[model samples]
Structure formats: structure tokens, C-alpha cells
Target: MNRKKEILEKLAFIKSHKELVSFGVKEQEVSHNPCLSEAEIAAFERKHSITLPDDYRFFISEIGNGGFGPGHGLLPLNKAIVDFKLRDKPNISLNKEFPYQDDWNEEWIASFDWDEEYPDTEIVDAYISTAHIAGCLQISHFGHGCTFLLVVNGNEKGHIWFDGRADYSGLIPKMKDGHRISFIEWYVTFLDMEIENINKSLTNSTTD
Candidate 1:
């Protein structure tokens, strides 16, 4: 199937699943407010000087904007921008190139003295700046500040990453078979996992 058709089919499958519905998956208006049209997307891209990844671009344009996706839900483009601006430091520009070639060092984290007056805010700010992807957006939230990010620019463009800065301290690629997965792959995997969980739950319930 084509990309558009594949995305719509997957979304429809999610919506139709009874287990998914019980888990709070619901469809929302794609042709209304909060959802972007091709014109709006073009304008946003021009303003930001960056283009969204193909899979993600298709999603917001063809599927839905903010109301129905992985984790809590996909964030609307505008909302994602607003949130990023609020959290980002003034010196760091979203359009600037992301610096790191790999995930932040885990060993370096052990050197920090938790007892001292360490500048967690400043440290995290630096990390975010270095890891920032020019046109990337937060596509899903896993609660407590963890999010799935779609890379829209730079070397890792078109890949989805797990932003565990809130809990684990840095961004890491969502890998499968030692390769980073794209937005569509990640979304499909998520849906499959949810479906599996639902089936297991039903089986357990019936046994009891």
C-alpha cells in the first residue's frame, strides 16, 4: 500500500480495536482546528526553515493532528512549538544544527555530585541544545516529560528517538535490529504492543 493509505489503514485498525478503545484510543477531526492543512504546513516550514519528515508529515496531514497517537497523544504542531520555546533557552535556536553524533554519555553522568548544589537546569539546558533537531517535533508523550521525537533535519533525519531526558537524562534512538526506526515503524510497533497487552489481559481475566 501507499504511504497515505498505509497510515490511514493503521489508524483505522487502532480505532476499531475494542482493546485499543478501552485503552483510550479515539479518532479526532483532521480537517479542523489544531490540524494543519498543506498550506499551513508549508507556511510553518517556511517560517522555521525546515521540513518535517515524510512519514510524520503524512501523519498530521492525512491522519490527525493532536488527539490520537502513541502514548498520551500526538502533540499539535503549534503546541509542540510553544512547549519547546518555553523550555528552551534564548541562546539556543531551534534552527541550529544538533551537535551530538550519538546519545549523551552515561558514564559522565556518574561524575555529578547529587549532594552538591549541581545546576541540573543548566546541565539539562546544555544537553537539550546539543541534542536539538532543527525541525524536529515531539510527536508523543510517555508522561513525566518523556517524549518520542521525530528528527526533521541533520544526519539522523527521518528517525524517531526516545527522549528520556526527564527520567534517563538524554535522547536515544528507538532502535530495531541495531538500526533506528522511522515514525511509521515506531507507531506500528506501539500499536502491536498495545494489542498484544490487551489480548494477554483478556486471557488472564477469562482464566480467573
Candidate 2:
């Protein structure tokens, strides 16, 4: 599929909608930010020593670099490291391959004992070192402490994982119809769901 074209077309549809606010789109949220130039993207890749997943790279380069996307919008590449505190923690490697292949068992997760005396930073650091994807970059904040992780290396390269930090310390593959989806697919699915909600709202309003 021509994901780039599909993304652009859906964005245009969202932009042209008259009831954007009703659809949960904030003013100037779509197509308002400057996209990254090829040079800038290249520089980022060179500095990180890894190639970004193609769909994500294309979105930032061709669509918009930030300010409009799934969740709290795609984070700017420059701010990603700091926003995610990748530098503050030495163990979080942006080049290490993502390590997990499956979701952590719920019962096993529940077994984690929270030490009241344990420093929050230490707890977070421990999790980061053990579970965080080494070369994965956060692409979006899905509200309630959830974020989308794009793997740039390891077996999961090119796949997007849903980070459910608010509820649990686990990464779940973003799946659709039992199949894993890419960044574009995830975003498009989100948009489509929003559109469906908008239509429902409109229909209900008319009937009332």
C-alpha cells in the first residue's frame, strides 16, 4: 500500500472537515508544523547510527515533523530524547535492539512488589534498563501515560508497540485483526475510529 499517499489523503480529509473540534481536533493541530528536511533526517540517522522506520521517516519528512498525529501528536525528533529522558538514564540505549518478543504475563506483572522505600527514579531506571527497547524511539503520547514506541532495531524493527505505562509496565504490539500494524496503520485506524465517532455524534444530534 502507498502509505504516504494514504496518510496525506486522510490528513487532507481531516483538515477539510468543518466540525474538526467536534471530532477532537484542536485548532491548528493538523498540518501546522514544519516537516523535517531530508538533510535533517539524515543528520538524525547519522547521529543515532540507525535508520528510522520508513513510514515514520516519511511522515516526519513529508507530512509534518511534529504538532499533529496520534495521541498528543508526534513528538519532535530533537525533543524526543529529552522528553523521554533518554540521556538522563545511561542504560537506555537508542541503538540497542528491542529485546522482548511477547507480552509479560499479567500474573507475573502483578507479582512485582512495590517497595515503599524504593526511590521512584530507581524503579523507573530499573525498568528502563531491563525492558525499554534500546533503539526504539517514542513517536507519540497516547494520553494517560501511554505512548507509541517505534522500534528501529532488533527483531521488532519497523513495528510499533503500545506502551501502557499508566496501567502496567509492558509493551504490547499494536495489532489489528490479529496482525501487527505499522505506524501509519495505527494512526489511520485511530483517525478512522474518530471519524466514526464524529458521524455517530452528528447522527444523534440530528435525531434529537
Candidate 3:
């Protein structure tokens, strides 16, 4: 079977259990939001002047629009757009180039004085822009201001990025085995982990 079909099976498996291992169960409960249609996906892409990554596009259209994903579940695509707008007062357009190709502010995350680091007005503007993480979808919120981003434009298009600006940690690519993590890889990894957790729970019950 194809990846989407495989994912569908896994989602079904996750739903079979009353007790789920993943977070966001209170809201999503292994149930998916309605799947988006191909036309709708196209419309969204046109509206934003972006091409949604294939895995993510397939996911929303073939699997689920949103629900039961990594980090407090996926936001429905439209909701993601709204979330992006609400959080970014500048209303950065999705078509804009994503500001970063790699991690920003990843080093020297230690005690510091802003006066020394951002000594100039230009640098201050850049510092503020770094936190925006423009040109992506705000797909998930892990609470405390942390969110997962799906890059729709720029060099990192099709990659998932983690924004930890909540703690001033900065934006970074989500990586596995030194390669940028794609949407399916990230989501399926979570599904497999949740399945394993359920299996372990079942085995323990049997042993008891």
C-alpha cells in the first residue's frame, strides 16, 4: 500500500484503543478532522502563492485535514493559516522567503546583555524578524508559545521546523539522521511510537 493508505491503517489502529499514548487526546482523541479536497488544497496554495509539500498535501487530502499528529495534534490547514495570521501581527505573507535555512540563535544561548548583542538598530530589526519565522504554516502548538512550522517556500520548502522562540531558543530545522525531517516521516514516527506504547500497555495487562 501507499504511504497514505499505510497511515490510514495506523490511524485506525490508534483509534481502536480507548487509552492513547499521545498528547492532544482530549481534543482530537485519534479522530481526524475532515479530509480536504484536491480543489480546496489547490485553492489554498493559490491563495498563498505556495505549493504545499507533497507529503503534506497528500496527508491533508488523503489522510486527514488535521488531527492526531505530533505535538498536540495537527491544526486543520485553514486553521493553520489563521493561527499564523493571529500570531504574527505583521501578517507576513506565506509567499515570502523563509528567513532561515538553518538554526538561528542556536549558539551562546547563555546569560547575556541585549546591549552587547544587539548594539545597532539594524541588528535589532533582524533579531525581531528572526522570531517571526515567516513563510510557513503554523501547524501545531506544543504550548508555552512553541509551535511546529511547515515550510512552504524558500530553500527549506517541504521541511518541518521547530520554533522555540517561546524561550528565546530560536528557529531550527527538525532533523533525523542529519537529514531534514519531512511531514510524513514526522507524523508516522509519532504513530509508530504511539502504537508501540499501546502494545506495551497491552502486554503488561496480559502479564498481570
Comparison by lDDT, 2 against 3, better one: 3
Q: Residues 64-150, candidate 2, lDDT per residue (tens digit)? A: 777767777777777654435334534335667788667743454466666644336766555545356567777777776667887
What TM-score would every model get versus the actual structure? Answer: 0.76, 0.79, 0.83
Ranking by TM-score: 3, 2, 1
After superposition, candidate 1 runs with Cα above 4 Å error: 2-10, 16-35, 84-94, 106-108, 115-117, 128-135, 202-208
What is the descending lDDT order?
3, 2, 1
lDDT, each prediction: 0.66, 0.70, 0.77
Candidate 3 lDDT at 160 equals 92
Tens-digit lDDT track of model 1 for 106-152? 56566777677555677656655534544457767777877777777
Q: Give the TM-score (vs. native) of candidate 2.
A: 0.79
Candidate 2: residue 47 lDDT (0-100): 84
Best prediction by lDDT: 3
Q: Summing lDDT over every window of 10 consecutive residues in candidate 1, give the lowest-scoring window.
A: 24-33
Off by over 4 Å in 3: 23-27, 83-92, 106-109, 113-131
Candidate 3 lDDT over 1-208, as tens digits, reads 7886798788888788747564455456777888999999999889889999999998888878988777788988877755442335454468887878878873444555766664465543555453357688888887776789888889898899997766668888999888999888888887898899889888999999
